[model samples]
Target: MKEGYVIRDQSLPHFLTVTIVDWVDVFSRKSYRDCVIECFEYCIKNKGMTVYSYVIMSNHIHMIVQSNEGKLSDLIRDFKKFTSKTILEKIQSEPESRREWMLERFKLATESHSRNKNFQFWQLGNHAEEIYSEKFMWSKIDYIHFNPVRAGIVSNPQDYIYSSASNYIDLKGIIDVEIVQIPVVNVLKSSSVVKYNSYEK
Candidate 1:
């Protein structure tokens, strides 16, 4: 961990962004991104992680998340450890065009730090911001959703399959998310809202 980047309150939800080392486009391929999706699913189902929203881009990922066990930091650590090893293995086993270059970069990153024994996949420190209010939460969610759009990958956020936007719009997503349920004050004749069942509702 880095100074001032440690998780202080594990109970609160956080907006976290994790980038690849050296900004490598490791997730440009489906297999690499699938590894991330698998990790997210495994963590959510078994590691007590609660993911409200997420987006997987070419070289990074953004998520709105916490942990049911109040061990968000531990969950992140485990997820990164497992994914780094798995992704590195895949890069070695699979026919990757940039295998040598990518492996060299990861090896360099690992050598630069004493914590790693072989390679470093994710960059140090998750840029995490604690979510305090509904407004801030929505802002972070929108920012996460529009990342691909801002990068010109897609025009509509919902069109991006590797994001929570489809899940929010009631589409079957790559991974299930625990949507936050905001309290509703009133309902008009022609207007109603969907409510989600989860801990942080």
Candidate 2:
């Protein structure tokens, strides 16, 4: 296991989340935050990456995405590459006198990775799991939304501005997108469950 995260996967539809080393909250920057948006937009537009749910935390990001073309890895790689380049370039090129310290911090943090020519905006090998059932999917989704709330960053899931919870709860500032909305508790209802044993993974 690398970085205490099990990096095993051989298929699509993997629920994925990644964090900066030491959980440094790099996403707190507005330009860095927009890098993520641009990456997702790129994947959605060109890679057939269907996003089910997402939550952008201060240091990490949780997303449930599936690629129909079996190119999930390619999509993720490009997204990370694009975001890192854009965010790092933005921080390095900021001419504001007060922002010089921030550039220093980024440069120091990324010094170890030879793969990166400069600032490494994200760490390698994201934590990911296959959503095998309704229960798994619901649990992951709930875990994501409840993160900020449990951390006391927000009182309610909907109060966190950078998450899908706001979309699920108050239908707040998120852009419209198609999603396969699954119920949280219906998986526990055995009577309501439809067993399709005829299907194969």
Candidate 3:
């Protein structure tokens, strides 16, 4: 709705990236990151948002998600709105060293946007790309899971506690994700084969 970014099919899984205002590393704190986790979990439980994979970085979150209720855009709008208010409140009440600086950035961001009032925590528009094929889906998933590794935060993707890679590897993570099995036509075996069989659970 913001221009080129369009959720053509609300029911299909989409790779979404939501960034913080001024690229602020708000999620550098576990408490703030947990706030995002809580909101995603709530959406999964109550809003029929099926999350295939997700990773929370220092300033942004990348998620592969689809809405069962055909309201992906609406879900994202509410998610941004809620997280903005919740995180701003946390920054105000909590003992944050960068409290004033962060609030000022939020205030400036709000002033730049007419729709926002007082403060703006997240940047406008989600960089969304719909998954049209198994290759594309896996590519995006790998990108999301390996973000922390690419950023030199961890040696292995699974070592990042804020990503769904742990869950894919049969390890416990911040939250459980719905693993989508990719079906491939194997020319070697001359049959269709499924990858990620361990994720059947």
Candidate 4:
């Protein structure tokens, strides 16, 4: 039996945040962080997801996103699967001297969860809470940027190179996700809209 439950809403746009196991400082390691970024970039280009904002914390990730032309659940699932496998392999195959101890520790943690493999990169289902309201959306965005600061890792959110904070703050650029915010009119109107001009009696 799966320990986590899935949440879905066909009525409104969705935003999801996922955390790591035991809050282990995964993002502190460059290899693991790079793997995550690789996966996210692949998804945006290949999958039909519009990733708005994202931040990589010590042990978690916050993403403001919605599927543009695909199922959100499927996209998330593939991201997790592909990242876990590729990252684990990258760690195992790397010639870096420092990675040996880190890889051993990861192996130890994955022992209980490994079904038929040597190691496991991530735990079970990622906890998700849908963002429906404007306040909630902004709150999550701020929370994502502030995660590294709260952990005492970086002084400024923009200094954290693994996040979309710099892009959001400067409106300059992002690696995988686009930083453009949906206009109020876009959110309020249906997919097909001829014009915003209107008159009422």
Candidate 5:
């Protein structure tokens, strides 16, 4: 992992991206996406995680999160480990049309890494970029909310149910998030914007 992507300050909130191995569309299924939401809810309730903003795409997830317990790295590690196991099990047991294909891909992904026993669901590293300034924080939140729009999945950010964009717009989201109470003007004035595709760490 690159040094910039490393979670240097575990106590502060960071913009995090966890991509699927080989960019597989594991989360294209609603069941798989629900598993991720359940995991996030569990983390928030039991693991001291505070999700400020988030968006769940087909192959990856982005979030602005911090740990009240000041153990962001550990929280993320456990979240990934649990989600990887649970989602893999679901793919095998649930009514997935691409079960065999997905399983084979996951199996092949583990061949190079001896640490994995059967499969590798998530790709290594969280691509964590610490939120250093207010402008950067809002920029990441904007980037996250607009992901589905950029993909042509939804015309409006709040129309995406799997994202916290709805929460920002005052509608009840699928999962609870710690809404940042910044003025709309501040979000618009955040000049140092971080583009989604331009992120390389």
Candidate 6:
């Protein structure tokens, strides 16, 4: 992993990107995407995870998250491990059109790493960038929300059902998130620095 991508502060919010092996579009299916949502819910309920914002793309996920227990690394490790096993099992058992193709890609990915016993679903390293400033935090959130739009998936960020952009727009999302309150002033456009306000419960 690169030096800048390391999660030095586990308790602070960080912008994280977790991609699938070979960037396979495994999450294009609703079942697979729901699997991810279930895992996130479990983490939040049991692992002390505090998700500010998130977006699930075709082959990757972006999250602005922190850990109440200050164990972000462990939370991430467990999340990937459990989700990998569960999703792989689902692919094998469920009626998937791309079952063999996806399984082959996952199996081939394990060739480079001896850690994986059968398949490597998620690629290594979260590419974590700690949210050091409010501006940086909001920028990542915008980047995450606009991903689908940039990919031409949706015209509006909130229209994407799998993203927390809906929550920010006063709509209920697939999962609950700690909504970060944007400053009253238009700090994003200002040249001066600004601090993050408290989150809305």
Give each model a TM-score. 0.89, 0.77, 0.90, 0.75, 0.90, 0.91
TM-score of 3: 0.90
* Candidate 1 lowest-lDDT run of ten: 192-201
Tens digits of lDDT, candidate 1, 88-134:
99999989999999999999998778888888889998887899887
Candidate 6 Cα misplacement greater than 4 A, ranges = 1-4, 186-201
In model 3, the runs with Cα more than 4 Å from the true position are 182-184, 187-201
lDDT (10s digit) by residue, model 4, range 114-160 = 56266555666756667777556656666777677787978777778
Candidate 2 lDDT (Cα, whole model)? 0.68
lDDT (C-alpha, whole model) for all candidates? 0.83, 0.68, 0.84, 0.66, 0.87, 0.86
Off by over 4 Å in 4: 1-5, 10-13, 96-116, 180-201
CA lDDT, candidate 4, residue 177: 59
Q: Flag clash pairs in model 6.
A: none
Which pairs of residues collide in model 3? none
Candidate order, lDDT descending: 5, 6, 3, 1, 2, 4
Candidate number achieving the greatest TM-score relative to the actual structure = 6
Question: Which lDDT value does model 2 have at 15?
Answer: 80
| Each candidate's clash count | 0, 0, 0, 0, 0, 0
Sliding window of 10 residues with minimal summed lDDT for model 6: 192-201
lDDT of 3 by residue, 13-132 (tens): 899999998899999999999999999889989999888999999999999999999889999999998888898899999899999999999899877688888988888888889999
Better structure of 1 and 2 per TM-score: 1
Model 4: clashing residue pairs? none
Q: Candidate 5 versus the native: TM-score?
A: 0.90
Give the number of colliding residue pairs in candidate 1: 0
Cα deviation at 8, candidate 2, in Å, is 6.2
